[model samples]
Target: MASRSPRTTIFLLLLAVSLPFVCGCTDYGGQGVEQWSSDIPGGEAGDAVFNTPVQSAFTGEDESGTGFALQRIQPVMDGAAATEPRMFPVKFETREYEIDIDVNRSVYEGARTVDKALPAEYWYDEYRMLGYYSSFIGDPAIVTFLDDVLSPLERIRRSDNLNDEEFLELMVTFVQQIPYDSGAPVYPRYPVEVIYDGKGDCDEKSLLLLGMLSRAGYDAALLLFPEMHHATAGIRISTNGNPPFRTFTTSKNEKYFYIETTVPTYIGLYSENYEDAEAFVVPLGNGEKRFTRVNYVCHITESYQKIADRLVFMEATMAEWKQEIEDMKSDLQYGTYDTQDAWDDDYASYTALVGDYNSYVEKYRKYAEIYVYIRDRPYDIAGVYRRIENSNVMDITI
Candidate 1:
């Protein structure tokens, strides 16, 4: 499909008006979610770890961190709506892939240097862990990292037949088997700790789950919130029925399910209180090329709309409006649009243009088509401007 156009004046206004509440402080950056199955190489193919009736080593501790419980996970709520499929695939040869490889070696190896595994200090700043993993997984540079590194590991685990809930339980069980290090302390623990000492912390546990999930061929993402970083994998949202979930397949005959690897919580457990936070996903299919935001919510309040309309009223007057577009065009042509600098520039220009209304609409009407051409998208603002420009009726106010 052709690229979507950038929002015209009206669209920009609408977007601003429709802005969702900014997520509370959280570092949400990581590779898209991946699911692994027994077909890959190491893990169980289609069995749930919890359902196997394995005895728990830790039980009965609550706030003081002394006990463990095998509480049955509650079923996930049927939320607002089924999510759309991933919009873009990780382009095999893009710059995203190269970045991820470097990130993998850096963080993966960096953790090994620390003497202790699963440090307490690192728990607070989950972003550091997220950055390291995101660098590897989400970066388009390491397109096949999920398949190459994680698949073989899952093959050995033989978790090929497990469903999402089962797989999550299995991961928790696997972690529970290894005790957290209480003697020594390290800032960041090594990935080797999972097998080396059979222990890991939040990031380590999450990564282990990520690796296994990737091998299973499931699409998932890492979620970073102010206080915690977690994982939320996708389950087919459209199907209807009790225990309705999408299945995972390894070979032609074998299949597994989605798992929530971060928490000890089982799969099939999500609700408004326990929700799916915003995440970035790497699509497995051949589709778009950008890292589309996932699980995002936008709410348009009347107050926001009023502000947006006023902004559009002013943006059209500045001669620099077209100049800004030209600059963006040049940057895009040379591939600088992805740079932080470019985003900053766009933010500045957009912010400045929307400061005044009458002048903004006047200029926008004259060049609405050209703006649409450059942006490759239309907007409510553009519609308004197009009408005003074509009709030459300048008596509208918001």
Candidate 2:
């Protein structure tokens, strides 16, 4: 028996694959790639394909150069155990592509300071790398830690004329109190490290200050400098102040102050060394004591939609091949052996088909994640996609 060439086998497989999905010789799968349609049952009109029960879990990758853990606050049912819950799948199409956010404005009033003492646990756990990123720990514990240690600072909060010079003085005093260590453990020890040892780093001081200001009812954000590996938190300046340091006032017009959490006051805002750093600001959510702005955070979701779509398409193709092989086997049992040569030819063809099927199966089995990038900000979809695909997932910060 003679085997058919690989070209012939692939040609037949292609033909078998093309006949079913092709409608009038047109392809709907590859047209300008439509946004997720939200026209599914129980969905709003003109909505794109919407995924419900968005799984909120952390994923870490330490690929030498790339690593990041995807983190988000997900809704949890009361009295329910800690497990992945089921969600709905909604589909829709879009004429003009845009993400619809259901903003809850009723919750956010003006930012106010939480007058309670900062809890030492929240502050410690936030800086302590050991259980810092663990989901088991709640926000209250960390908040409490901040309150316990920074209580003194919060108590001293008064309605003062917070001018540029006064604000700089406060910043210098705070920085001078805390020590900076570049080699600190990834996790923070909080007041234990700062109070007892009188030492910490940019992130630690920032957290301490953040907890204090928030408790005092001042609106602030954790300003991140990724390139410089630093964090500085301060109130958002409402008006222009001095040239270097911007000033954002709190909910109380009288209580306005500028904060530089990382560096000592000696290195003023004009310190040219930290100029042009990559910076991002995350506004704190206003709770009972703290002032949280409505829709302050961006909704960023990363979907492996590209890889998922590819898997779906390939699986559909494999099913077609499997059906063909089954039909061929049926023919063999029915005494439809056209020739000995054809039988031998089918062996290699079946083998190659099996190989391709197994390869796709393996790919589908691997750790392919669908990152749904959601942010409260109007982000560039194309740019976001490019960053996720090109850079290490850890480098992706919403």
Candidate 3:
């Protein structure tokens, strides 16, 4: 698969039109409905944080107590170039890997101090400056840092004998494990700054993941959900066996599978909150690597969905059967029966209902076991397949 061209122009126009009116404040822990307007002239361009309204100027100190405001400010040149080696511990599945990188104080400060204002040409782009914010992923300074980060990951890949999909998941899980900075600046931070600060919001973390994946030779893009005021990373992977659960296609008809970076989630799984909202994909660099194990992931996702649906139906049926059995019992106790045969017939029917309910209970338990196994060992494709195959949950094979 080949990497596609950049769609900065189209992405900016979409951002301008989609996000006309936004709330002045946002709560990352909760999903707040944002007010939208289509009549606003020109675009309201702003930072990647998506919290502050375009009209509201940045103010107050961040949680770090930095004197800097959230608005676009001039870089404070301190002429410091000291480098500090830092270790970031990332946990994926049952294993924990420590990634070490040398952070340049000068680069980190420069990134923090860089101006975040959008160019004059963008119309109302300030509300979601995705095109502008994406530039940080390819910054010379950030690129250098990402190169160093990839070195250790490459070693881990060889040592663990991980396949392409597993390697990609490991890299993604690293970014997902980064502490989310609810009080981050309105502007998106450079990848270097995100690492040095040890935290980032959705946009900030997405940028970091994009850079890392791109540098590691994966065709990736940035997914912007303007309506939801959220962003996620996307990548081009082989969906040969089963279709992907969620993906955003560009005008050129290229599919980028959704990958949530702010929290730990399955690669192709998407959030239901923004599942109906429109999204735009901004392809990053041109890379050749593609995630080939999407078939395994799709099988697991499909089986999980089937098990969940069956469980729901079984629960509803059991509830109805229980109610019917209780009603028959009540009638037998309080209502008049014309004959003993009538009473015996009602009792037999009630007994049949009870038997059916018991049978469903056993089936439900079996399905639940399969569901839990897949949920817990999502990456263990063979194990999941064997568990499903051994039991009578459903006819699924990988």
Candidate 4:
């Protein structure tokens, strides 16, 4: 139980790197922004415009001077997204709607050699496209953003008189408040960028939530629903509980509720459309992300219990040490021990107790941190992803 889980280790490395990003890079002030064209309202949700090549400024009739169309996409790794890269339930107030997202917009689909200076426009696309390009496996900048946000929440672990579920609720609320930017780029947002830019789409918000939750010591994951053309974040809870939204169960039988990081939605209350959709849950930064399917039966509360048990012991020990020191101070002031020899001996014992208290304080802090990282991890997940895997937004299905 003391050993760090692979996911936790990845988070630590990210956090270590993240230390620098506390003063985040603001404003992607590029030369020019790449404009995106998606169906506003009139265009068909499932139309061929997605497959239509985005004619570039570089393209023409030779002296018609247009560059040849780029081969932007190969087929996605899975056939689920063959028609569209992302789909989702739009209005949660209705609980009946799903948003059809066409990730057909590919600013950067593959590696390119810069023959000329390229163009300032492509550079801007590359900046917006950065989130899409990353799998978010142990990124330092992301971890740093997580560290800053979680530092405040970490106090909750030691704060007094709070229900076990209170922290989870607070975490969900914190993520829910993250501004949802519909106009941002199509792909996900890097965690730090979300903080600096003050907005993100579902995919971007999800990564931010994942980073914060991971640092705070919760078992967090990224859930992709291709059929709905949407992605959201979720945290591993102890049980499958009384039925509700979809849940991903690991090989060891841990259950996680699909929490929507975009909107402030309830944990188990998801859109009817997304309730039954197949979800591929990725535990960010855990090596070889093997997806665990949503299940209705069998779950484990060990992760919750493990953390609670450790905290209870540490808290109790901390209290006892504080009381001991206080009592010694009171005795010394009152002159309860008359003999000088007796007083000197008592003082020695008092100093040793103080040392013990300080040591445990530091020890518990570290233990809790590791506890968050390890227990919040998916157990026994393993597998290899394809060359071009669908992570945040769905890859356009050929």
What order do you get sorting by lDDT, best first?
A: 3, 4, 2, 1
**Per-model TM values vs. the true structure:** 0.29, 0.32, 0.66, 0.38
Return whichever of 1 and 3 wins on lDDT.
3
Each prediction's whole-model lDDT (CA): 0.32, 0.33, 0.60, 0.41
Poorest stretch of ten by lDDT in candidate 4: 379-388
Candidate numbers sorted by TM-score from highest down: 3, 4, 2, 1
Give lDDT for model 4: 0.41
Which is superior by TM-score, 1 or 2?
Answer: 2
Q: Could you give candidate 1's per-residue lDDT for residues 22-53 as a string of tens digits?
A: 21112233222121111112223222121111
User: Whose TM-score is greatest here?
Assistant: 3
Better of 1 and 3 by TM-score: 3
Off by over 4 Å in 4: 1-134, 156-164, 240-242, 251-253, 284-398
Task: lDDT winner between 1 and 4, please give it.
Answer: 4
Q: What TM-score, to 2 decimals, does candidate 4 have? A: 0.38
Of candidates 4 and 2, the better by TM-score: 4
**Error in Å for residue 377 of model 2:** 39
Q: Compose the digit string of candidate 3's lDDT tens values, residues 102-184.
A: 77777777777776543333323333334344446544455556666666777788889988767787888788778888787
| Deviation (Å) of 386 in candidate 3 | 5.7
**How much lDDT does candidate 1 score?**
0.32
